[model samples]
Target chain A: EDQVTQSPEALRLQEGESSSLNCSYTVSGLRGLFWYRQDPGKGPEFLFTLYSAGEEKEKERLKATLTKKESFLHITAPKPEDSATYLCAVQEAKSSYKLIFGSGTRLLVRP
Target chain B: SAVISQKPSRDICQRGTSLTIQCQVDSQVTMMFWYRQQPGQSLTLIATANQGSEATYESGFVIDKFPISRPNLTFSTLTVSNMSPEDSSIYLCSVEDTREQYFGPGTRLTVT
Candidate 1:
């Protein structure tokens, strides 16, 4: 069965603190890994997509790296505005355009 | 990225009633997806709506309980039948644009 597990259910960091969230996935065949940020009472916003091992993508203050079995979302000098639930999902190579999502990590950057 | 919008951002309905949520995209898309996000849980794909075809529902979901309609390439609707406390969730619609899916604001439903 394909499954996704995210570590550190919740994290509280002071402003400017940097950390990384982990997403471990088990799939029949890896196709793509995605990262999204969701705010309270809102829908998820697309962040990045990593397709192969050693692939990395970065935004303003966020960086996502992918490997054979897992992915990591690293936040650098996170501000309060960046506080949101970070979600990770994976697509199986053999399946159609469907995504299996993780429980997500609730991040709070306190000012 | 496609710009998506959902109607009736939030609503409170009585049990056994029904609610229909609408999703519209700025551009034409071949595939539109509906997802359910329970409180504190991850998003789960309910069904995939394709233009000119029956919606493909995922396992643990049924067409009778959750019917979907794809009238055109840019619009779709998901109706929650027989609402219950378990049906209280955030319903989101997304469009596939070049391997990336963009989501709408979502409709928050509360069943009482």
Candidate 2:
């Protein structure tokens, strides 16, 4: 079975604090790993797509790195605006583009 | 990225009533999907709306309970039939562009 798990279900960080959220997956064949940020009362916004191990992507204060069995979303000097539920999903190589998502990690950056 | 929009951002309906949600994408897309997000839960795909064909429902989901219609490449609708309190959730529409998927604002439904 394909499954995705995210650790540290909830995190409270002071403004300018740095932390990393973890996503571990067990899939038949890894096709793609995606990260999304969802705010209250809004839908998810795309963040990054990591396709292979050792791949990394960054945007402003956020950086995402991938490994064979897991992925990490690192937030550097996060601000209050960066507070949101971060979601992780994985696509199986043999499946028809369907995504299996994790429970998500809620981060609160207090100012 | 494709921009998606859903109608009725939030609604409160009584049990036994039905509600239909519409989804429109900025550009034509080959694949569209409907998902349900329960409070504090991750998104679960309800069905895949294929243009000019019957929608493909996921396991544990049926067409009679949640009917989907894909009239064209950029528009689709999902109707939640015989609503119940357990059906209260955020319904989202997503479109696949190339290798990535983009979601709409979502419809927040509250059933009484």
Candidate 3:
């Protein structure tokens, strides 16, 4: 069975505080890992895609790094505007484009 | 990236009724998918809307309950049938572009 798990179900950080969210997976074969940010009552917005171990991608104040069994989304000096539920999903290599998603980590950056 | 939009951003429906959500993309896409997010739950794949063919539903989902239609490469519709309180959720549509998926604003449904 392919599964994705994200830790720290909820986090409250002060504005300008940096933090990291974790996503661990168990799959027969890894194809890709994805990160998304979803605001209240809205669909997810794509943030980054990590395909292989040791790979990393960054956008503005967010950086995502991947490993063989997990991925990390590091937020540097996060702002209140960046507060949202961060989602993690994985694609199995043998399966179609289906994505198995984690429960998500809800972050609140208080000003 | 592709820009996607959905109609009826939010709605409240009585139990046993039905509702249809529409998704439109800015450009033609080969793969379009529908997802459901139950209250406080992660997103789950409902089906893949294939153009000119019957949709491919994921496990735990059925066409009879959730019918999908893809009339063209850039448009799709998903209908929730025989709705109940348990069916209240956020329905989202996404398109695959350049090996990445882009999502629409989503339709928030509340069943009474």
Prediction RMSDs, each to the true structure: 0.8, 0.8, 0.9
Query: Per-residue CA lDDT of candidate 2, range B83-112, in tens?
Result: 999999999999989889889999999999
> What order do you get sorting by DockQ, best first?
1, 3, 2
DockQ for candidate 1: 0.89
For candidate 2, the docking band is high
lDDT of 1 by residue, A1-111 (tens): 999999889999999999999999999898899999999999999999899999999999999999999999999999999999999999899976899999999999999
My TM-score estimates for the predictions, one after another, are: 0.98, 0.98, 0.98
Which candidate comes out best when scored by lDDT? 2
lDDT of 3 by residue, B2-103 (tens): 999999899999999999999999999999999999999999999999999999999999999999999999999999999999999999999888878888
| lDDT for B33 (candidate 3) | 97
Q: Can you list the residue pairs that collide in candidate 2? A: none
- Per-model i-RMS: 0.5, 0.6, 0.6
Query: In candidate 3 chain B, where is summed lDDT lowest over 10 consecutive residues?
Result: B94-103
Clashes of 3: 0
Give me the displacement of residue B49 in model 2, in angstroms: 0.8
Instruction: List where candidate 2 sits over 4 angstroms from the true fold.
Output: none
- Candidate 2 lDDT tens digits, A1-111: 889999889999999999999999999899899999999999999999999999999999999999999999999999999999999999899976788899999999999
DockQ of each: 0.89, 0.82, 0.86
Q: Rate the local accuracy (lDDT) of all candidates.
A: 0.95, 0.95, 0.95
